[model samples]
Target: RKYGGAIETVLAHLQESEERLKNIETFEERKEELKKILAQQRENYLISAREIHDKRTKAARRFEKEVETNLKAVALEKARFEVRIDAPNAADLQSGNNRRLTAKGFNQIEFYFSANVGESPKPLARVASGGEASRLMLILKTTAKAGDAEKSVVFDEIDVGIGGRVAEAVGLKLKELARTQQVLCVTHQAQIASLADQHFLVEKETVGKKTRVSARDLNEKEKVEEIARMLTGAQITETARKHAKEMLGAAK
Candidate 1:
């Protein structure tokens, strides 16, 4: 009785098993198809990577030139800046020697710099001092045209190790940069502060055992007074005030 009632169920399972075995026998055929697809995809990837490499090379040349010019403006006239790009070429990709792929097409970029005359250019991170780094950042950030004006850029102590003419030049460069986008700069130099579209004063107050730090925007008169104080140490001389006024006036 068991064989009579259950024979159909056993036969159904056997049929399903035979279908699975058929699929197993065709596995080698599917593997070959997948291999062909992979080769086609790899060829497309190499072609696209090579195209990206060429565009990067063209842009890097222009970037190097602009950075060199701005370096001169920031009293880094003797400084040399380079945009170095390392990537596999079409020939390298064709030989299947470099099959590694990345999101950015296998291109690596680094900034090289020489801060003094007669010095060979080296990797920027290894050779740049605090002051040189500040100047270089300003040039790179301002000269970069890759993004929109909505991007906010902040520069802290950008005037480090610079004063007098160089400070004023930096202020001018900052002003030019601000014309396109939002820029916030922290500076001790009166020259830079005077050119700001808006100025905020940061003060630290000690209340009992606690210290409170606050920042408040300055009005026009307050801005002038603060600038004058920056020019003169303890006493704000008439000459300093007049000079500060002139600087602000010239900026407008």
Candidate 2:
């Protein structure tokens, strides 16, 4: 009886061990399934990212062409503007074979420019002057397709260092761009100010010990006067008003 009881206990222990082994094997199988699912998701993400990269590459080329064409209108006749897409190599990633991605894309963009003939294109920050930069930005805004975040574009002193025919070109360019997008340009040149769909005069006044700055929207009469003032400074002459009227008429 003792021997029989001992055998029964050993069999029960062996049975318990088998159950534990089976449970362990089942858990390992589940872990492998989870790993496969994670890998598949990663593949899908990479595929989508690659598709986005391809689209941006094509769009970048088109954007570069449009901006270059507009640059000529801003009097940069010999200028060369390029939009470069710097895509990363697979070897640069942490996994060595995986894509390096960011929220924007897997590529970095740089605007390169050369303002004069025979000059090699250089990075925008390294090459373009303040006026050149402003004009370049204007060209970009004029040609670029508006995104969700770009509701309005404002230009402050884009007419700086530019006048005469160039200023007129800038004015006409801005006016044309405004047809497609909302544009607010602050300019002191009579040529540029005359083209505004809505004109506002910015003035500063001394009240007591403090200085205050105010912007007042101009009516037709006010616009003419303000544009005349821009043409001849504080002295609004009759000739300047007649010239301002002519300019306003030509702008339309």
| Clash count of each predicted structure | 0, 0
Candidate 2 matches the true fold with a TM-score of 0.75
The numbered model that scores best in TM-score is 1
C-alpha lDDT of all candidate models, in order: 0.86, 0.82
Candidate 2 per-residue lDDT, tens place, 1-252, comes to: 443468888788789889999988799788999999978876676677778889988988888888888888788888998878787766564363544566665778788999999999999999988778878988887677452344677887688777888899999888877877788887888889889888888889999999999998889999899899989999999999999999888877
My TM-score estimates for the predictions, one after another, are 0.80, 0.75
- Give the runs in model 1 whose Cα sits over 4 Å from its true position: 1-22, 88-99, 147-150, 204-213
Output the lDDT of residue 81, model 1: 88
Q: Encode model 1's per-residue lDDT on 1-252: one tens digit a residue.
A: 433458887787779889999989999998999999988988888779879989999999999999999888888998988889998666777777755578778788889999999998999889988778877888887789443488878888688878888899999888888888888888899989989989999999999999999999998888888899999976998898888889888888
Q: Give the TM-score of candidate 1.
A: 0.80
lDDT of predicted model 2: 0.82
